[model samples]
Target chain A: MQKGGELVERTETRLNPGYGRWTPFWFLAPAVFALLVIGIYPTISALVTSFRRYNITRPRDGFPFIGFENYINVLSDQTFWQSLGLTARFYVTVLPFQLFFGICIALLLHRPGLGMLRALARISLVVPLATTYAVVGLIGRLIFNRDFGVANQFLNAIGIGGMDWLGSPTGAFIAIAVMDIWQWTPFCALIFLAGLSMVPVEIEEAARLETSSKTALLRYVQLPYLLPGLTAMLILRSADILKLFDMVFVMTRGGPGAATDLVSIYIQRVGFRVFDMGMASAQAILLLIMTIVLSRLYIRLIYKEIE
Target chain B: MSTTLRRVLHGAGLIAVLCFTLFPFYWMVSSSFKDQSDLLASPPVWFFTPTFANYADIFADEKVFGSIVNSLIVATLTTALSVLLGAPAAYALARFEFRGKSDLWFWFISNRMISPIVLALPVYLLAVQLKMLDTYLVLVLIYLTFNLPIVVWICTDQFRSIPIELEQAARLDGADQFTIFRKIYVPLGLPGIAVSAIFSFIFSWNELLYALVLTRRSVQTAPVMATSFMSGYELPWGKIMATGTVIVLPVTIFALLVSRHMVRGLTMGATK
Candidate 1:
């Protein structure tokens, strides 16, 4: 016991700043450990497996050290190339349309409305975003079915021939794309709404005082402000679409002869369906590399998202 | 006259898009009620007497309630665990600077982007070895691949916003770091937790691939079971739609419930 105090608390007995400063790490220990196990371990294991041939049925055979053979075979495969091409098609087809429509809806919804109504509108828009892809895909398949679908019914009512959506290649692809855009555009719109709220009304008023045309104001001020949000949605959604699987899996199973298959579904087919883990690993590595490359470019182009 | 015409065009376009966006969902509900013959009619049915048979068959005969239970269990447990592990990590990253925090953050996010199917084989094998397949726990753990990072990322914002004085105040009061977190941070950051937890729950609930690979007969989730309805032409369209309506409607209701927090969570660090 010191002269001035009967007993001083051990923690309150301040050490050098460095001593207690690291205490947060102690608090952070469990989370970081778990993240490593759940996140890093399996990922590293996947990467390792990508290099080697893995067979679950013949586990006693062990994962042989196949080296670049898996990579080489995958590189030469026609289906892998086609799937990659389709994945690109999906990205090209969906991204711009979604961004444009999302922005438009956000603008319309930004008007003065009661909180409850606005909230209701927000909920209605967000609901599709939360629904699982499998459920959406299943419904999409039903809706796109030529004989039983409401979509074909709508088309038929207009004196147009009912299209066999899932039975054909292009029709099936478009149907899936449309389904995706439907589910995701609301997500983009919500992001846009978040972006819009960040716009300073004063800037618009100042632009108005300057007699800035609405188009000019939007072109210059609003669009510029929305870039970060748009960039984020772009990266996030692009990555998501590149890996589009469950929807396609449920909707078409990559069929009408592998028309709607994307990279992820291709990985699943090879790994699980065909039981070609080596080839599957190779294909997975290819997609992962491409995604990483694109993500890098995306980050470099729009790397201002530092928090 | 020209501006009015332009406004009219815009209005028409907006309404058209809204209806188009909503049509799939609308048709789903409608077709669920459509009779089989009417459903399969080449032109399809715009009007027919509504039928509860699909819902009846799905709930009563097909036994979809089990899948719903799976989805609920998976989503809820994953949310709980993600919060348990992710919150402290987020807090540490937000508040402290011992070492490697930036690297840790980047690593957490990179894991989020690695497509989940890549891990499916290994995880499947692991599940079999552990004999944990088709169970809620595997779904919860598999879900952490994305959900944990999400919790970590979302709470990073909230924890950053909390003034250090709160933590310091607790520390000065002889509270340990754990005590500080429980008493001070968890209470204040409950809203952020709620937002991310709802999202975490939704993510696991909606996740299909791991659930599909991990479960076969016993622990089928709604998403996995829903796929059975669309397998082939032999599927009864009305029954499929009814099941689809039941499966999706809850998620839609949930989305409405947490639209605000989800709005924030989806944006992550974009605005802030």
Candidate 2:
């Protein structure tokens, strides 16, 4: 038994210095260290803060821990409920249009013999991404203005009256959705183009040369190749749209009447504007949970076939 | 005729998209030239007499030039820190074999997944605790949380794409790991680094939320400066548009110049 123990120890020592070494930790420490302090710790702290009533105004009194009361209030609050509905509306309106426009443009540019047009299209698509969201909001603001704006000018040119896009609830929601589609369609298109470029040309050519069945080619040949990338882009875009804040904050501040308030925008107003840290933390925790849950579910549903 | 129909439709689609994208930017520049009353006209003005009063106001009242300088410094610092931190990390990942590697990688990227607004409150508290609010370091750290991952991700892609035999050949010549990276990999990967740096700086410069939450009037950046009038009693569309133009012009030019590289960098690994 003693000889067996000695042999085991000797084997472990030799192996540790060789194949299954501790080297990855050295490469990983700085990134993991920063992320822990900045990303992970803050999230855990936010979760803990949600259970306590923390008002900076009364720092002298200090925080009083009240377990789950904040969560109860947040879940039951009418304004919180409205923001939830508004966020859903945003996701519904913007995501489909984003996917459609993105896929359309990706397919359009996936052809041959349109060099200059394709180049111009590619550059134009990504310019919005380079612009800051606040500036983007303002750009959308100037264009969507009901009066003395280009949208109205175009409406007049088409023999139609311009509606107040940011002045009413439905109109404001539409305006915010429009802003989202404008900002992110390029991102979607780019991802799809990346995926499109990777599609096997011989398979496509085989379909074109050997068979003239467009539907069969699309339904089988192309879709399967593009599914993984489309899944990734969709999950990312969905999560991002749910957390949309900067543009809405700059454009409407949850606007004409809480119409454009996304989940993050709701948290920002509650936390920053009203100075209700407890309630805000509750909202933040909720949004965080919803985002994680939805993203995981989406990834699971879309990628299940691969697994 | 079928092909002709396709060409005309494609042409129209191209025009529509260009108009959709550039019209807003054009109006921003055009609106800066319009007078206050002209801006408020019932229908929007397509062609108008141009002026530079709005631009004059931004430079004069808001001290737009100073904010631009502030923006430049913060962005440069943030980009530099991310690259400095990220390059070493990327090198470690590309060359080493270690434990919990993938988990560590995914953890680094959780910053990108988790919303910044989630960290806004705690980061605000951490900044005050460290007495680092409104300092360049604060901006660097906050931007680093998100930007470092990008650098690591982009650089890792670039590093991995380089053939391993070259590194082996250098090693056989008695070159150490650090020397090999510096002498060979760094020069080869310089363009990728440039792309990554530009992107990090652009993201850092264009960020408004953290700057809005952390900084005050004295150390305010461009994005925060642009928001000055929205809180005022009266709206100043012309002056606002002027600031808007100034903020976007640099990024617009930068984006067009680096479009090809940006495409490659952003779409990294997605195709593969």
Candidate 3:
């Protein structure tokens, strides 16, 4: 029986020898075709549309080829630069708050034997993470509504006067950032928690024998182990931040003098509100280039550290 | 620090984190049950008889009900289609040694890096030209860009993790390639497939930008309808809160069900 089984196995394996060369190709074809139509084709079309004056509102004009005009126009446009600047500021400001809180929460919940507290924290954290961005925006609007909003109401209860959150430029910008931080800090925390859990117990125990201070142990041992997770969090957050749109759209709508106009919102406005497809495509291409380049740089840095 | 002091500090930090993470959801649910007068009350009425009027108002509207259905259909169909197409490709990449395999792998992973804005205009124009705007099919097709990469990434990792001995044993039993994939790989890869499905569902459900621009009147999803409440006159704080509650409830419940898998799901393909 064993010999017969071995003979059958060998023959069966030989029946599909050499990785079944044609099978994988057939298996991969549907996905490749889907990506081509949905991803690659549209991207190339966007590139083509950027060089033409294709305004949806102007059906009579037709999509005449306008070489470099849209790109040059976007380069000189003040709103474009302002939006880019705001995107950078939003990313820089919110990231540190999220990371700090994330690390703190991760450390607190990373204890090995604390079953109940860790479970509670994990459940609570998923609330903000799972809440849709649009809902977050709506909640922000409610909390920041100047007249009866809870934020101002809380301040007034403490004898501080109510401040206009959405009506003012800086308040609106800060409110948007706060909303982002609230929604995403949990994500960072959870990722950090996962990273922290991977730190071997023996390594920590050895460090504890040598060091008396918790901070020293963390700084020397745990942080180095968490470097990869930190890099992953940074890359993921930075990419998403660059493309942020929903909160700004729902809460501020780039209002009170374009205070919270992130690049995504600006591009959407250029395309849909202004019906300037050419300019929007140009701006989008630039945004895409920036996103890809920055992500590549981050990946390179992380890869070096990994080695 | 003394152990007592350390314990106190840790408890305090945990409480603060919990409150920060959960307060918004509390406020949303509470406000959803508040009357319009109670909703806008200064000093924010903490004690009040909760009302279902807001929920009643939103459910009474046909547009809102239609949007809820639209969101369900789009998210469901997108999840199914992405897994169907993406899992096979992931299996191929995981098991086969082909020319340019590494390059293909890199391309599949890097596809996640592309911003939706770059695809928005071209897709919108294409939809317009093809007369496919305001249709469920278009949203499902476009959502593939986001969902497929994740499916491929996670499913590939999943297939790779399964031992090759199982497949060899199946082959020894005289099973062919298709039978091995169906009877062996699919059943074994269920956990990973479930994770990928949850991811695709959450993404398609939470997606706003594509839905916002792609559909207008006939096919608006819940998120798009939720945004509509913000734009019009007399910002109906009651109905808006109610809508927010309804939109968040399903996803929150789903997340809690799979809370244990949250970290593993998010970090699956990225960590290694």
Candidate 4:
């Protein structure tokens, strides 16, 4: 008892509202330091590099500050506009399919009962999410192979003869879309499931009593709950789709004569392959602006506030 | 609709989703284990005597095997660094009312919106200037920056959910701030940390664009090895599949283990 009292006395003296004003800064300093060095610094450097003629091959001609020349070149180039349009098309193509199927599957999984099956289904969803993007491209290549692909085998079973999946412009575009949809649709479903879970049991039961039609009930009751998550998904997806590379790079490499050349791949070609650093940086900076602006638009228009 | 009919439809829907998600995985693993002829068979041989030759071939190749090691080192270190740096900042954000708090939060979260291509060239040049290209340190540092936002975002959510009374009690017991964080918040907040770690690991492991541009022969990652196959005239399906399976297996297992918290993690803790 004497020892405990002594310890309490020492503790009381020590507990003098110990935390100071700079405590949070001390905690945050390391991360903030690292971000400043690696994240913000590089971004500023990229912004600077975008305005100059910084081609690696032409070092004799020093990187002079040629304001807007690189931007003008990127903006005026027909190939850049085509690639940009294709990127937009890719986003438009995949979003609807993913959202539609995602919600449908989430609704199915959201149903009460089927305990074991529901658990198993959720586990299976992680496979696609976990698959490396490059591997997803390779998987696309193997599956879409004309001669020996499982895709053709299945199509043959269904009595549709195989066309060149990665050869023709239309086919390659579709193949990339299919791969993206396969990879991301599960993400949509998972997010929607989280949203659906928020629909209170009492509310769901009452709604079920009011209408036997699942569609009617979902339209009236659940979709409002889903809107926030749906908006989140849209913003994230828009950002991702705009910057997509790895998988398409592995699968097609902007292939069969620039058929599947999304903007990122094109920028990479200009930057690394063509060694035009300034032009590539300009294109990249523009792409970055587009992504930020698009997400901001989503937040302002669809997602007013998220708590 | 009858109860039985509704049940059957639900089962059908479940089957469709499973097939769409898992069929490619089955194909990849099955093809990886098949002999060359069976792998290239037209009616894509459903049944075959599995062989370890493809796996053996990949393991025997020095470059292929080396990249697997490189991926492991980079990803593991990146995960460790992200959690170590990000957790404390997250605790601060969760607990303290400080100046520029909202602005700081937005700044960190907005990092995710920056397209990698925007920074790719500049990062490549920075590495060149620093003479750090083709090294694991560069990759780890860059990945840490990318993964930090994820860790901070999730852990902040996790830390916020913990009761403030716990911290008050700890303080009453004379525990210091660091002690409260390390002892109380860290343990209670572990689920969030693990989820973020798993995500960080998977992302770094799977990352390609930065890995491709930054690392050359010496520190090339597993994804780079997988993509190098595309340059060859003859596509080796069996070996390619084996390499992919090896690369993806660990992270897939990690992801499945934490499926419960995945929704919260993926959505940056916006839901659940």
TM-score of each: 0.90, 0.91, 0.94, 0.95
Clash statistics: count for each candidate: 0, 1, 0, 0
Give chain A TM for each model in order.
Answer: 0.86, 0.87, 0.90, 0.91
Model 3 lDDT at residue B141: 94
lDDT of 2 by residue, A1-307 (tens): 6687556546644664222244445555677677677677878888888898887777887889999999999989998898888777777778888788887787777766568987898888868878888887887777888876677778888988788988988878887788778888887777777677777888788887866776776677778777777777766766777667778888898878777887788888888887778788888878778777754555355435422
Error of 1 at B200 (Å): 0.7
- Candidate 1 lDDT, tens digit per residue, A74-184? 889888889888888898898888888898878766644344544455556876787778878887877787776767777877888688899999999999988988988
What are the iRMS values of all candidates?
2.8, 2.8, 2.2, 2.0
TM-score of chain A of 4: 0.91
Candidate 2: regions farther than 4 A off: A1-24, A210-216, A294-307, B261-268
Candidate 3 lDDT over residue span B1-272, tens digit each:
79877777777778888899998889989999999888768768888999998889999999999999999999999999999999999889888767888667666666677778889899999999999999999999999998898898888888999987687777657887778778877899988888888888887898899999999998999999999987666788888889888888998888887776776565444444
Clashing pairs in 4: none
Tell me the lDDT of model 1 at B178.
Answer: 78
lDDT of 1 by residue, B82-137 (tens): 99989988888877665676667766766656687877766776777789987877
Residue B115: error of model 1 in Å?
1.0
Query: In order, what fnat does every candidate score?
Result: 0.55, 0.52, 0.74, 0.76
lDDT of 4 by residue, A25-127 (tens): 9999999999999988988899999999999999999999999999999889999999989988998999999999899889989997677887788789888
Candidate topping lDDT: 4
Q: Docking category for candidate 1?
A: medium
Candidate 1 regions exceeding 4 Å error are: A1-22, A55-62, A111-120, A294-307, B1-17
